[model samples]
Target chain A: MKKKVLTKEDILHLAKLSNLKLSDEEIEKYLKQLEETVEYVKNLDELKTDKVSPTSQTTNLTDVYFADGETNERGLKLKEKYFIVKRIM
Target chain B: MNLHGKSLLELKQLVIEKKISEKELNQYFLKRIRKFNPKLNAFITVLENNQLGIPYGAKDMFCTKGIRTTAASKVLDNFVPPYESTVTKKLQEAGMSVLGKTNMDAWAHGASTETSDYGVSKNPWDNKRYPGGSSGGSAAAISAYLVPAAIGTDTGGSIRHPSAWCGVIGLKPTYGRVSRYGVIAMGSSWDCPGPMTLNVEDNAYLLKQIAGKDKYDATSSSIAVQDYTNEIKKNKKFKIGIAESYFAGIDDQIKKHVYKSIDVLKKLGHAVKPIKLLPPKYSISVYTILQRAEVSSNLGRYDGIRYGNDRNFFGQEAKRRIMLGTYTLSYGYYDAFYKNAQKVRSIIIENFKSVFKDVDLIVGPNTPVTALNIGEFEKYPFYGELMDQLNEPASTAGIPDLSIPVGLDSNNLPIGFQIMGNYFEEANILNLAYQFEKETDFFGVIKKGINNYKD
Candidate 1:
């Protein structure tokens, strides 16, 4: 597997996707750090996981369901069954 | 009456015998917190009032109803949880009160609490060094006797690493053993809430209170919770395995202390055998990718509209992780990074399952080295993963593991020896640790830690 080389543009794209606003200094810092992390994680390629299935959760549980008609307050501001939010144009 | 150097059980006994009222005991710890917390920065918030039950520190990651849960991040500095975490509720019902919200790495992202927005938690053993973290504050508070015990959640070595560095007992219970309903999610698949205490018995006792299925957390197991405090007294002999791969690249002093602990286990009639397991380096890769992916997903809910400060308040470490996760989970890259890491996680789980078929438990040095000095994380790009190399395997496998103080390094820092057990076998893990504690008293490491903070 070839290593994925991250670039400044890639950092910007990721920052936009993650809803984060990074300064010029942070972009430069992350370019180097994220590249290092991505490179380090490349070691996983050494294992052949083609035949194996991905484990989403460890407990061998299926169809875990909460009992019906159970409700708890979220503690957010509410008025007459409607949540209040900032007005947007 | 002086309550210094007393164990949780001792304090409970005092209250039962009327030697000290619970209110007085809480005041005693509050006085100590006022004195030591300034220097150690172990707590982000201290509850000076409401002294009705036995007091203990809670890692800031666990949400307490009507109390601030910062998670050591500026983003959530003012965010108070409206409902209680199952762990804290269980502890409170078990006659424990929350003393304070202890500091942690922001969003539980780093190994050292240096990343905490509230400031770093200094090691109780050496003020100049870090208390290994993101559970650093919990470990430090227990080490300094600021609180009798603390509850910390471990995604990957957050509890054991700090416990090792702070010379305390920390157990990372098998995934799904403890409810994670209100814990600020880091790695949802890997997050485990467990106990950090001054002694093995306290660790067992706390686990008994918090370990069980919860209707709130779907992943929590339905396995029967054992009376761990009683189970440890059985004095069962375990077949312990020492993996050489865990020792590779470890500090010489830590290796020596772990071997010495193995010798003590041997003296106590437990069998020790050499076993081959997957190298820890592989788990580091799997942990980093999967954890980052989870962090990105979890943090997405924290828009300023819902709660917490805006995204701009995220620290450098959290931003770096979130960006990496976004990149990996992007349209084209998900199969390569996120899915592959999960596959590797399954492989690691199978590796542990196979090894446990022959041995009852695995023991080794918990951290590669003792607690490092403050400001040392800058040298390594992936400092937490490297610091937690020996710990990530059990975490990745979702098995229970415990770290107990073995001895101190030449610098007078604590070294931790960890025992890894098969899935849902905390009783067995606590049994061996209890036996060793009875035989060696953790080399007086826990006692010496409290002696440094004499009132």
Candidate 2:
């Protein structure tokens, strides 16, 4: 398996996608750490998984249902049955 | 009025007989917490006025209604949950009071609680050493008798790792055996909320109270919960598998203690057979990729729009995990990383399924080594994953496993022996652990840990 070399730009892009603002030090640190982590995980490539199906969850159950209902109580800060959030626009 | 070294069941018995009032018991633990918390840093939030029932520490991951629940991160430092988690609710209903919300790694991201935004939790045995983590504080608190027991969620090795290091019994029940509702998410597919206690009986007692299905958590199992307390008493011989792969690279002292434990099991008339298991190193990669991916997704909820501080409050470790997750799940890399990891996770699960056909349970050392120095985590980039290599296979396979103190190492740090069972087989895991506890009394490891903080 060819190892992916993680560069500073890749780290910054990932940080952006992850909604994190990394300091210059953090970027440099993650660049090295993330590279090492990525390299380590590539060992999975050694296994032949061609015939196996991915297990997104272990429960082996699908389409589990619950009675549809709504309670007035919620953990979020709410106003008039709507969550209050900072305006993005 | 010395309550030191008393198990949860013993304390309950005392309360029932009116030997000690519940109020006095709560106060006893409260005073201990106040006295030792400054030095140990085990708890993030201590409830001084909690006078409801028998007090136990809850890993800060569980949401307690009207009480602050932080996953040891600054982001949720002020986030008091409006509703209670199912596990805590069940424990509360079973007459357990929340003494405090214990500290953990930030978002349960690291094995060492040094990643905690609040502070690192020290090992009760040696303050210079780390109590193995994400559930480090819970394990530390239980070990030091700050609390009789605690509930900790294990994603990869969060509960068992710390329990091993702190010389306490920690069970990571089968995935979905306990509801995930109201617990802070980390590796959603692998997360299992379980008990950390000073004895196997208390661990079974707590698991009986907390294990079962919940409507709110879709992944929770529909299988009937077993009467684990009674189940532990039944005399049964198990076919235990000794996997050489699990012992590979384990410390020499740890190997000696674990093998001694296996010999004890053999003496108990249980058959021990050598079995081949897939090298645990493969599960490490599967766990790292899949867990990081799940973490990135689970943490997406913390936009600061509804609860917790903004993404800016994420710790360095959390950021690093999120970035790697994003990189893997990003365009063009999903197939090479995320999807492939899932396929390998399937292989690991199948591997355990096949091994269980020949054995009732698999036993081995819990961690590769004993408790490490506080600052040793910085030496490795993926220190938690490496430390948790043996534990990840069970986590990935969604099986039940327990960690019990076998003996102390040369440094006086605790060595842990693990017994892993088939899916939803917590009863079997607890039974073997209970039998071992009766035979060896865990070599007085738990007693020594509590005596370290004797009043």
Candidate 3:
């Protein structure tokens, strides 16, 4: 998968949606700060996990019995992933 | 009646024993506010007409029904919530008096209160220095002994950072330990409201009153509230881990004072060891993205169409964060920013978890620097980044971290001790902090006086 790299214009567009009217002098500050932040976060992008299952919850609840079985947000997890994929794609 | 230097617990005791009346305390404090607030600028609005006639607590971001919860942002300058925040309700019910509203960074965006539109909160220690912030006003008011204690919300160290710099006690309870309802939403996933006091006992008592379940906040955990005051009174010496990189980037004088404070603990017979915790560099990086993302979304409630009454509503910093957050969480940039930050957040949490395995608690400076000149961040806004250096890590990990005044510097400004505990180990954290407080009466020395000023 080719990773999506964010451009300065992307931040500007997002900034607009956020209601921040950036001055011409300020675009570069966000770019540099966000870039430094993004570069640091790139470490997460480098992780290789071919053999290990990713951790979801910190606690071990491999088995549990519930009468009502609250499955509301749990099922939405699948829907959310699908939606996220479609949106990101 | 004038108990300016008393900690919250001491004040409560004094009030309960009838040594002081609430009216007298309130009048003294209201008088102090009138006397010194001109110099300190610690308040956004002091509701002198509230007719409450008492020294009630106030955190700048927490909603107080009818009093205004502007979050020190121009965005909320005129916006007032119709209801009281859960914590405020609890405090009011507990007979805590309302002094008035303090100021903060607009919607709690920046670490220094500089982001606030209402104006800056200066340190009571030296009016020129920062009181530490987004809870800078609460910290300043409390450190100046104006109120002795005030509720402060910690989102990425708003409470603890300022508490540290201001030479007071501030606690960031474990994630979900305190209710988030009524706090003007800043960063929900990371926001946990706590107290800034002049002592460990006061912090614990405040935590006891504030920590509990709330149906209003579904993410709030169903945890049993432990009496932290009693717990601290009967605690053992703890094995504390020294966080490696947290103290690394700090300036030399601060490093010297912190190390000497640790030596005091070492002499007290606790096993202290050097531990390689998560490199703290990721805290601000992860927090910045997540905070901006959340701020953008949560503040959408403040659209001129909804919360704000006028189209000209919203303050400058609130606007900046909303715009920044919205931009980051927007189309084409969501994954590039928010989701990526979340994944990195996972890594940061994992790093801290790995450290907690070996250590019962971690210790470090609350911020890289102690306190700064008021409004310094306004000129060099990037300096705010340096302020939350040690704060964001503990806050992001959602663990309990307490800051206590360690000692003052050559310039007479106070330095603080920060102790991070494993999840739900606030008992141990508070205990260790209490023991450290006992070792040196440094806090008492801090309150030598904020003497009455004549205008």
Candidate 4:
């Protein structure tokens, strides 16, 4: 199996998608770590999983909606509800 | 026995017989935590109160109302929860008091407690070594007799791995068998809250108090909770399966102890057989993918909106996982990485299911090696992940596994095995472990570390 080698650009793109800002040193460090992690995961290709069904969750659960009210004490603050971000317009 | 050295059952009996007051028991442990926590670094927050009945150290991952639940991360360093987790609330109802929030790997991301932002928890047996984590604080506290037992969350060997290294009993119950409400989420499908204790009876006693369904958690199982204490008292011999492939690459000293444990079981009249199991290496890959992907998704809520600090509070390990998760779940790599890992997960589950058809339980080493020296993480960057090689399969399969101390190594550090049962069959795991505990002196050996246990 060809190992998955993550490039520098790939790490930057992932950081953007993950809403994280990285320094140049961090990018270099993560590029090496992410590449190694991806290489380790590529071992999955060795197994013949053509016919196996994917297991997203072990239990049967769906549509987990809470009641409409101020019931959750762990809720977001008023300013947090709109989520003011420095970059997001 | 002194109050701190008694098992959960023994202490409960003391409470019943009026031999010791709850306030006295509470003060006794609180004093111990104050005296020993600075040395062990086992507790992130020590609550000094006079509450009753088997005071347990709860891993900071579980939210306690009005108490800071940090998950050992600076992000939530001062984040006090407004609501209590279902498991803790259930335990409180059954008279278990909270000693404090124990330390863990920040965000429960690493195998060693070294990743904890608060500081590392030292092994109770040897202060120079790590206690094993991300539940190291709870395991360390139990090992040091600071708390009789503690609640810990296991995603990929978080509970069992640390407990094994710390020389205690850690039981990771079947996923969904215990509620995850208010507990910090790492891998939604893989995270399970279980007990870390000095003996199997306490493990079973704690499980009975905290295991059940709750409307607050959709994933909580509706299957009735068994009388696990009664179940453990039974003396049924089981057909145990030993997978040679699982034992390969393990330390020779640890392997010798595991084989000796198997010999003891055979002498007790249980039929022991060698069975081929799914390769654990593949589960490691699958676990890496699924856990990171879920972590990326679950951690999205920590954007400094409702709670804690900004996302910048995430440690380097957390950032690494998030980046890996983002890349794997990206448009091009989803099928090749994320989807493929899940399919492999299905295969791993099927492999365990098939093996259980021939035998009631599976046994193997809990960790690849014993407790590591505190600075070993810097020497080997991937130390945590590689150590969990033996535990990933059962964790990914979401089966109940108990880590019990089988014996000690050359350095007197503990070595243990993983006892796994079929889904929702924690009773079988507990029964077998209880019988082993009765026959062996491993549990008693740990008690010798207690300072004031009156014979």
In order, candidate lDDTs are 0.91, 0.91, 0.73, 0.87
| Per-model TM-score versus the true fold | 0.96, 0.96, 0.87, 0.93
**Native-referenced Cα lDDT, model 1:** 0.91
Off by over 4 Å in 2: A1-4, A67-89
Name the top DockQ candidate.
1
* lDDT of candidate 2 over B97-158, digit per residue (tens): 99999999999988889999999999999999999889999999999999999999999999
Per-prediction backbone clash count: 0, 0, 11, 0
RMSD list, candidates in order: 2.6, 2.8, 7.1, 4.2
| Residue B308 error, candidate 1, Å | 1.6
Predictions ranked by TM-score, top down? 1, 2, 4, 3
Q: How much lDDT does candidate 2 score? A: 0.91
What shift in Å separates residue B415 of candidate 2 from its native position after superposition? 0.3
Task: Provide DockQ values for all models, in the order shown.
Answer: 0.73, 0.66, 0.15, 0.49
- Please state the error at residue B122 of candidate 3 in Å: 0.9
DockQ-better candidate, 2 vs 3:
2
